[model samples]
Each structure stands twice: as structure tokens, then as C-alpha cells.
Target: MKVLYVLLCCVVLCLNVLASSDEEDDKQLVEMERSADLENRKRLHTTNTFIKKHVKQRTVRGKITHFVCQNAVTMEKLTFMFALPEQNFNEDPVIQHAMELELQREMHEGLDLTEVEVADLAYHEKNMNDLGSDRRVMLKPDLALLILDIILNPTNYEHFDFIHTCRMIGLFWSVKDPTSFITNAEVTPDDNTCVIHHGTTVVKSFQYDDDSIVYVDNVTHKVLNPSFVLDLA
Candidate 1:
């Protein structure tokens, strides 16, 4: 009987130790998770600060009304429009000269163009003479990088307002079905509407109003209304 009691006590003591160890493990896990989350937040804050500082230094003016990007591997194309608020073009020679210098620096660092090719392209496409002309300017890849940078990393609506204000209207078509895609689309900036048509049939439509932007899915026949607020700073 005394031996039986001793065995029972030992078993109880073992269970108590196990329970305490499990509780301690759970507590350590929770603390590790909390520390990880805090570190992630700190890293995010640092990254955002760095991006904002750089964005402020680069002066990107003018509204990119339309942009087209193509995937190199798939040959898929993305054509989009933005209803950006108009601003007077900056004609300050100092700012223009500074922009030219920056463009030269970026070309040297980012592009694989020779010095001669760079000068020729910059003169023809990005010179102040062509920029000030009344005709529409065709931007080459080198100059387009500046606009793409602003579009990708926007600090405010004034920086690039499309993500917040406009609807993303995309059409996916391959070389097989090229004729079925939209050949011509009209962008009405007054009402903020872009309607893509295929042989008189409305393929995709996006409309924006005061409170929200509405997208009509032709495939599902469903309506999506996403709310947006214009941040004009």
C-alpha cells in the first residue's frame, strides 16, 4: 500500500512538471511573436521614411494621361488612363537644367545606352525645345522611366492620383485573339469614364462619380462600386 501511494505521488508530480513546462513554452512563443511583429513594424516605418525622402527630392511634373506597358516574356500589354488634375508646366530654366542633369545621371546608372546614343535620344525626345512645343510629345524609354517612377511610388495624389481616383480598366487578349480586343477606346475626362468597345459591343466600362468609382464586369454582369476620396494637395 505504501509503495502504491509512492507511485501515485510520483505520477502526479511528473504531470505537474509537464504542465508547467508547456505553459512556459506557450508564454515564450507569444513573446517571440510579439517581438517579431514589433520588428516588422519598425522596418516598415524605416522603409517608408526612406522612400518619402527620396520622392521629395525628385521633381516630377506633368500629368501622365495615358500609359502603356508590355510584359517582355508574355508579350501581354497593359494600357491605362489617369484623370489627373492639370497643372501649368514649369518653365523655369534652372529646374529644366536640373531635370536634364538628373536624366543624364539616371541614364548612366539605369540604362545600357552608349553616351552618343544617350545624347542623340535626349536631344530629339527630351529637349526643352520639344517639351515647350504645342504638339504632343512622344516619350522614349529613357524619359518614360521618370514618369514610371512617379506612377509606381506615389507620395500623394498630386504626385500621381490615378490609383486613388480612377478605375483600373484592363483588357487581356493574346496574339491569337488580337482582332477581338479593343482597337479604339475613348476616355472622357469630364465624367471620368473609359469605355472599351469591341465591334460596337461594350466590352468593359469604368465610371467614376463624386463618391465612388463603378466598374461593370462584362463576363459576370456584376457591378463593383469602390469608394474614393480625392486628396488634392
Candidate 2:
């Protein structure tokens, strides 16, 4: 009877030790998760602060020119815009450097462009440069700034409604080669009308009035689309 009692006591002690160890593990797991969450929040706060400062320093200073083009062969429409500032905004060099670094990090970690598309962009850029095209070359920093401006202050842009749905941003270069699908092009001024021609033959034409560019709300201070901003963030 004495031996049996001792064995029972030993079993109970072993079970208590196991329960204590499990409790410790659970505590450690919770701490790890809490630490990770805190770190993430800190990172987000830093990014938001930087963006706010950058936006304040650089408001859309001048006219926004909207461009829409269509590929003749594929009929795929490409739309983009350029915000031409009258004079260079005097921004702090430190802020500019920080913004560039942050944008570079994001591009390195979260690039969504496919390899083929990237190759095509490079090829077109090289071809245009070789042919002495005078069009503005879209740089990485320019694209990042453009996106920030659009998301923050959509009212400054002409076609905010159309721009919100754009899959790609930045300048689109046309290849001058015979095999290029983007051979024919059209330009619409403030009148909002376009006529595309193929060697003196009118192939396609379209028009978009002021009604087409509608603003959902007039909140200039807040981000127009949180989801879109988060995707880029």
C-alpha cells in the first residue's frame, strides 16, 4: 500500500510539471506575437509620417496633362498623365533623399511588373533614346511621386475617375519600328476629343467630356482610395 501511494504521488508530480511547462510555452508565444505586432505598427507609423511630410512639401504646382493612347493591333488602351510644374518646388534635400530611399526599398520588395513587361519598357526606352526622341523619360522616382500625388490629391488631376482605375502609371513610349503595334496615335487637348489616323485614313475616333470625369467626394485632405494606397504601401 505504501509503495502504491508513492507511485501515485510521482505521477501527480509529473503531470504538474508538464502543465507548468505548457503554460510557460503559451506565455512565450503570446509575447512573440505581441512584439511582432508592435514592430509592424511602428513601421507603418514611420511610413505614414514620411508620406505626410512629403505631400505637404510638394503639392501639384501646375497643369496636369492627360494622355490616352490605343495600340492599333491589340486595341489595348493605355492612359497616363503628366503634371508639369511651372517652377521647381524647393524641397529639403534630406526629405528628397529619404523619399527616394523609401521608394527604392518598396520597388525592390514589391515590384508587380512582369519580366516581359519590364523588358519591353527597357527596349522601348532604348529605341526612343537611339532615335533621338524628345519625350520625357519616366524615372522610378517620378513614378513614385506621381502615384503619391494622385492618391493624396485627386482633385488636381483632370480625369481622377479614370486615373483611379489605371493599372499602370508613368509615361508610355512608342516604338518607331514597323512591327510596333502602337504606330498610330491621337492627341486630345482641353476639348476632350480624339481622332486616330493610319496613313491619312481615319481608323478610330472618340470623345470624353467633363461629365465622364466625376469625383465621388470632394475630400481633398483624406486619401481618395485607401485600398489603392495600401496596395502600394
Model 2 compared with the native: what TM-score?
0.34
Where does model 1 exceed 4 Å of error? 59-233
TM-score of each: 0.33, 0.34
For candidate 1, the lDDT comes to: 0.36
lDDT of 2 at 124: 22
Write model 1 residue lDDT over 50-89, tens digit each, in one string: 2233334442122212232212211112211111001111
Index of the highest-lDDT prediction = 1
lDDT of each: 0.36, 0.34
What is the clash count for each candidate, in the order shown?
0, 0
In model 2, the Cα lDDT at residue 167 comes to 22
lDDT of 2: 0.34
